[model samples]
Target: MDSLAGLVHGFSAAAQPEFLLYALFGVLVGTAVGVLPGIGPAMTLALLMPITYQLEPTAAIIVFAGIYYGGMYGGSTTSILLNTPGESASIVTALEGNLMAKAGRGAAALATAAIGSFVAGTIATMALTLAAPGLAEVAVRLGPVDYVAVMVVAFLTVGALLGASVLRGLAALGLGLIIGLVGVDGISGQSRYTFGLPVLGDGIDVVLVAVGLFAVGEGLYVASRLRHDPPELIKIGANRMSREDVGRSWPSWLRGTMIGFPIGTIPAGGADLATFLSYAAERKLAKGKRRAEFGNGAIEGVAGPEAANNAAAAGVLVPLLTLGLPTTATAAMMVAAFQRYQIAPGPQLFAENSALVWTLIASLYIGNVMLLVLNLPLVGIWVTILQIPRPYLYAGILLFAALGAFAVNFTPADVFLLLVIGLIGFFMRRYGYPVAPMVVGLILGPIFERQLRRALAIAEGDPLTLISSPFAVLVYAALVIIFVVSAWLRRRRSAASV
Candidate 1:
């Protein structure tokens, strides 16, 4: 079926009351996670993955879709009112939104953010709906060699673009590759990295790795940096937008969506780049009266970044659905979730699991509306959630991390393994290493190995055959271009800084 017909089918499947409730619950949890500082969607998804064990695949997926987008909108509350960004992408939101709130234009900031997210999300979802089906058709024609190329792009970009330094990101990716390769070899059925232990032969569970790195690891890292004082919050007045606010924000919203969705679909960093680009665009475009507001509580800054952040989130789903390429940490966790159900997301996904894919797309549309409704009128509630002490918040996360690890196989060994991984995560954070590339590598490494093996077998062990395919050559060329461009950009920035 075509995209439009598939969407109709999706709406039919997802519009049921039960699925709606699941979506609602997911958004509520996601929003709360965003409101709480130091907790991110990846960690939230990791901690709550046990829910997938209880609910059916469709229900669990619907809820998760809600959480994904809701988290995007949820950060607006804390970023604006408390100046504490819950996630890296929201850092820009706090930059301008907090100023607005401190100036007692808190209501206007919140209004623009909520409405702008809605506008961007809805438009981006429309783009996804139209774009994904055709992309899936193209992806279906790709061979194993082409898949290897795509995965290489995913790995190289993820490793090079994430974290404080390229070396740190690559190191994290290497660690994940090592851990992912621990199980018995699928082709030979021989133990590879088990070290003669039966437990190692089974390989570490994805749940354990995810919870350790995101939940337990983060908890430990944050605990090491706890402060004695609580942060003061700005009191928000009535949450409503003025006509002038609407006039200024609409253009920024459109521009941010235009900038964000395309970036989200690529591997060159996701929402972070989109937000920065949008912020720059808004600043450059601001006219006479608006120019002076750039540093102090500019509504355009908040509106544009917030819109881009949400639109980029929608854009991320495109590659994930069509090529099984996850561009972010949360997207990697989503891949893990798909694997849990033995449902691979890629070219054949639409042909084999059409129902599931369509329903998921439909849920995105529902989730957009749900978040707008949830965020607009409930500003005070989220602010209240933001006041939660970091100690209690992380304590609960650690507890859930333990529970999730133990629940994996009801084994104490898994829990121990979780702690070991968590410690690694702590050290990574302490040393300016990023955990996202590791998660992406951990999830994609197996897929890459399998694809590589398949390609090699087809070529009868000829290494040159790997690059013989035109698509593979193109992918590598693109990789080189990205690297060169990024390096040049870095040099330019350094020169300007000097």
Candidate 2:
């Protein structure tokens, strides 16, 4: 009943003309960025961060949230039409979607993706609405030690889950932590890694790192791999689904949402994992006749992964709102947005700014409906965007990256830092390091440091106090179990190979 009342109040706030306009604007820009190959929601949000400072807090956040989900909706269009995936989460969709397109069923593939996204997004938003407040209530009671434990959990989970290898993930995380420590020490009032450089005194901006790693690095990588053969654009002959298509896809959408949303809400269970799990689930559930279509452009393949992607996107917001813990790179950028607005997201955010929280939740549902409407009839338009020359598109993105970096501080030194970081980002990508963990490490490192200092102060420099609290002990135990299991699994795989 309380949840119901809260949602109703939230709708009232979201329904305001101003907030609705921001939501619409956000989705429109988000879709555009998502349609462009190699650009994901995190980069898009980071690029727009400077401009958002001019808007009201509610309006800016609404737009950011809209972009988060809208990017998921638009990511599928590129994978299906151009055989290019805009986001990693959409790669699974391309396996089946592009094949369906080649078979002259592009329309049905796109339609199923759009409809499945709507269904999954709607259900997942409702789950977030109901789950967030309860989580926030519990989070508010946590001590500094517990907070440190939570940060450790985030670090371990994200490090273990994102990369192809655990060592690579930890290395990326360590790099981020090192970058994060470059600025002035908050407590000691002394320089750490600045090395007499004034620009390094403030530490590197998160936006610069985000844009460089995702936008610049990804763009350069794609440019380097660009082929002389022009991408074959798939035509959408009939943008409608048949009854048979509907029958094939409806169950997959439901199953994918069921598989995705729960996993997404858990820490480190991001859209990539959710979509992969959903694809595996759908493949396993297939029987004798349908099993053959698993790799050859089945409608179920497109529908299920698309549903899972959107569902996981919604699920990721649960922790962001309740505990202020960002589960994905995009969520971390959103946290950065909150800090920009001087609005901290956590238990205090809900207590003092309930209207903002509720309104943002309501806008998610509205945005989901808007995405369905925009994606369905506008599929042809978005596909047409891919017809633009790759050289021009990438050049424009680089220009935006430069402009956004300059906007942050108007300093020439910042521009220099941007180029330096972009080079680092390029090497990181070439080495197959997971960029998300680096960003998470940079963003959370400071918070973790603060909590550690506070906890030590409370215990008179007794480091053991970190594990003295019951909650902290439990969290550390869970971390140990995760590490042990991961090691055992690696050993088992090694033995099997031998």
Candidate 3:
């Protein structure tokens, strides 16, 4: 009953003229960026941080939340039409979506993806509304040692789950931790890793890292792959789904949401894993003809994973809101946004700023509706984004990347750093290393250090205090179990291949 009233209040707040306008603007921009090949929600939010610094807190959050969800809706468009995935989460969508397009069912594929995203997002947002407050209640009781344990689990999962190789994920995480450790020590006044550079004292801006890696690096990588041969675009002949299509997809949407929401709430439950799990689930559940369509362009393939992707997106918000843990790149960027407004999202957030939290939650429902409306009949319009020439598109992206970097402090040094980081990002991509763990590592490393220091301080410099609590012990045990299981599976797979 309390959750119901809270949602009603949130809806009332979200319905305000100013909030509605920001919600609309956010989804629009978010969908547009999602349609673009190189930019993901994290990069888009980072690029827009300068503008958000000038807005009211509620409006800024509404907008950022919209973009985060809207990007999920927009990614399927490129995947189905161009066989190019805008985000790693959408990669599964392309496997079946592009095949559907090739089979002249492009419209159905897009329709299912857009609609499935709506169903999953709406259901998952409701789950978030009901679950977040309760989770925050539980989280409030946890001590600093427990929180540190949670962070460790998050660190382990981020490194283990994101990419093809666990070693590479750990390597990327190590790099991020190194970057995060630079600059003046927060607890002590001593400078660290400054290399005699004045700007290093403030540490590198998360915005610069996000933009350089996602936008600039992506542009360079795409530009390198540009050839004289024009890519083929699958045409959307009929944009309507058959009655059978509707029947087939609705159940998958629900199941995918079921699979996605719970996993997303976990500290390491990323969309990449959620989508894959949803795909595998759907494949396993299908019978005869439907099962055979797994390799073909099956509508179920598009529906289930896309639904899982969106649900997982909503699930990412749960931990972000309740525990102040960011499981996804966009969620990590949002933490920076909260810090910018002098607000921290955690257990205390609900007690201190309940209205803003509810309003942000309310806007998600509105954003989901807006994305469906914008994507459905207007499929042709969104696909037109793909028509832009690579040279021009990439050049514009690089220009904006530079502009966004300079906007941080109007510093030429930041721009130089952006270029250097962009080059590093390009190589990371070229080598098949996942970029997200690096970002996650940089964001979480400082938090981990802060908690570690506090824990030791409370324990009078006893290192054992970290794993002393029952909760801490359980978390560490889980981490070790996961690491061992993952390694065993990898070795088994390797041996079978041999």
Highest TM-score model number: 1
List, in order, the clash count of every candidate structure.
0, 0, 0
Candidate 3 residue pairs that clash: none
Taking the tens digit of each residue's C-alpha lDDT, what string does model 1 give over 218-317?
A: 8899877878688798989664688988999999999999999998999988998788778878888988989889889899999999999999999999
Per-prediction TM-score to the true structure, in the order listed: 0.97, 0.94, 0.95
Candidate with more favorable, higher TM-score: 1 or 3? 1
Ten contiguous residues with the weakest lDDT in model 3: 488-497
Give candidate 2's TM-score: 0.94
Q: Candidate 2 clashing pairs?
A: none
Give lDDT tens digits, candidate 2, residues 397-423: 788888888888998777777777877
Candidate 2 lDDT score relative to the true structure: 0.85
- Overall lDDT per candidate, in order of appearance: 0.89, 0.85, 0.86
Which runs of model 2 end up more than 4 angstroms from their true locations? Answer: 480-498
Instruction: Look at candidate 1 and tell me the lDDT of residue 498.
Output: 69
In model 1, what lDDT does residue 6 have?
Answer: 86
Distance (Å) between predicted and true CA of 34, model 3?
1.8
